[model samples]
Target: MQNSPKKEFRNDEALLDIQDRPTFFHWLILSIQHLFTMFGATVLVPLLIGINPSIALFSSGVGTLTYILCTKAKIPAYLGSSFAFVTTMQALMKADGYPAVAQGAISAGLVYVVVSLVISRFGSNWVDRVLPPVVVGPIIIVIGLSLATTAASDAMLNNNHYDLKYFAVAIFTLLITIIFNLYLKGFPSMIPVLLGIICGYLLAVMVGIVDLQSVAAAKWFSLPAFDVMFVNYHFKWYPAAIIGMAPIAFVTMTEHMGHIMVLNKLTKRNFFKDPGLHRTLFGDGLSSVIAGFVGGPPTTSYGENIGVLAMTKVHSVWVLGGAALFAIIFSFVGKISALIHSIPTPVIGGISFLLFGMIASNGLRILVDNHVNYELKRNLVITSVILVIGIGGAYLQLGHFQLTSIALATVFGIILNLILPQKARSEK
Candidate 1:
């Protein structure tokens, strides 16, 4: 049997890690690579939630910068629009409109800040102890699987009718993306997503599925409308909105932990111990609060960018800083923003099919890599329960607020892990 990856480090470590000092040009190129890696996901959130894509891009850049500064430039993670808040954002928008939703997002962010304080006081070992592989693996799985239907639904335009045009586009995009990722070499292979998108978009344009009017009508340069929070600011607190959104933070916090854990494994460094989880959580929370105030979606440390780091093996904080700068620049350029919005849904669906599935794959990889024995009944029971609860969209209501399946499953996993027999846990 393979040894647990939790105790293993890379045999061949990068001579020049993210902290290594590099030339300006080298850092710039690496940063741009990181930006391209996260570009698709950064914009997808706003597109789904009826927010301006420019605002999301801008907020991501600023939020990421905020994260970098908060962690004292020790961690190299990018803050991007979070998909976990989609359902709640939509519901809050319908209930009290976008303004209340924004405030609620800020409230949700404060939850992270509160949790960070708690961790700082008690240390991160408590957290890891409560959420071991048996618990976290299933939560990560649920995060990806819960979004599967949404990805497919968006690709098919949520219509009951199945259009071959979209199906063809999705298939072509997915196939080409996989092909490029596996067969290509050098820089071309590094950016399969950008290439796949271009191919799918060209096909979409030729098939008359794309609308060019938006791109043509958009100005060459203009300031993004920050109206979601600034112009639409109405500060009367809504208990339901705040209560509804805040609890979801607990759900995404697990995701934050997963991101840190994966990076630690990939880089063969204990970031959770070095920079500490408290500081990372503070950065993440601050980014979300800033995003809320700026009319952007809640931001989280992007898993896509983590994949980029593993592939490239260049781990410089400056690289993330450079990517954040480019994202900010993209937000100010109106034509660029419009161009992003003009990409066909089918094209995105093709990529989402791959991206979301990879997330689930990574979750399972966590179990296998860690040598987590499914043969143990305790491990099997915990994983099975969390997956069924989260994937099945089970909910628990607290007054006007509804805790999502992810949130419920997360709470249950932590509770189960704590209460399960110590002897059974140790024997496994």
Candidate 2:
């Protein structure tokens, strides 16, 4: 009986060891590679939602640092704005202007603060119970499929025959990316998305599908975009902002819980109770709030980055610390943005097709991994409504205000999931 306290003490010490783990060069290298992997996704959100790419870069850089501090530098998670918020942000910007909407989103960030507090005070298990794999899984799938439509539009951003040519480019790059990721060996294999991007650009340039003039015109040390904050602020669209950004709190919150759950599974420390979901939520919310202030989209703890951490087998928080430094360093440089933007639309178009689809697949994977069977009528209806609203319906407009299909779909998903009846939990 006297040994009980000693045993608990040893376990506590070991947990501390995991949190205070040291870093080495290999960890740094791994972190750098991971950074590159997320670069596209990182910039994609700001670009998609009309936020300045350069400002997005800066915000993401700072936001990452904020995330680390908030989580006490535990877990190798990287923070970036999510594309899920794209439609809502764009709509808010277009209709209500930017000020009121910005306030509304800032208010929405406060929602995250509340959520963080709840998770901290009670337990994260409640969040998990409310949004089980069954609910979140299909929603992820819808997000991916829904964005595919936008990818098609972007295929046009750099080319007119976007439908025909980009469809081909997208298919080719996607298959290449999948093959490399699944079968390729070694470090080169680790960045299949990057490889697909390189190949896609080459193919596009060779066929004259991509314009090369921008590459030369792009200055080596041009000033990064950090201005234009007040203009967006003055544009009051509070109603639209509230309606549009509020619901996304649900998406980001659910995603955050899932990442925290993953860290718990990986660290085997049950962080859901220790540093706790509340701490993690504050980190995530604070990170996004910072991103918004700097004219960037809201950030979230990335599940993909978690996969990278698992693969690297190096959980040194310092790895992310290095990555944060790297992002910050790049944020101030203008040439980086020009180079990324100049990479040819066909290349981005192709990569977007793959990355976006993978995002959707992850959502689908969530449902499958958790064994959320949909043979029952209730499950079927919940999924059907989410898909139609997310994937089938077009944008809706009321006078000056417009509600995007994606945002609408998300709202629809949350409602249906909450209301849907539960079938008996099957065997794991």
* Top candidate when judged by TM-score against the true structure: 1
- Write model 2 residue lDDT over 312-410, tens digit each, in one string: 334556666667777777666656555555555545556566656656766676677678777776678777777777778565565434455655665
Q: Which ten residues in a row have the lowest lDDT in candidate 1?
A: 1-10
- Where does candidate 2 clash, by residue pair? 98-235, 99-233, 99-235, 100-236
- The list of candidate 2 runs beyond 4 A from truth reads 1-51, 74-77, 82-105, 152-160, 163-168, 222-275, 301-323, 363-369, 373-375, 393-428
CA RMSD of each candidate after superposition: 5.0, 6.7
* lDDT accuracy of residue 364 in candidate 1: 85
For model 1, the superposed segments whose C-alpha errors exceed 4 Å read 1-17, 20-51, 86-98, 158-160, 228-240, 307-319, 422-428
lDDT per residue for candidate 1 within 183-220, as digits (tens), equals 98754654577688789999999988888998999888
True lDDT of residue 9, candidate 2 = 18
| Top-lDDT structure, candidate number | 1
Computed on alpha carbons, the lDDT of every model, listed in order, comes to 0.78, 0.63
Count of backbone collisions in candidate 1: 2
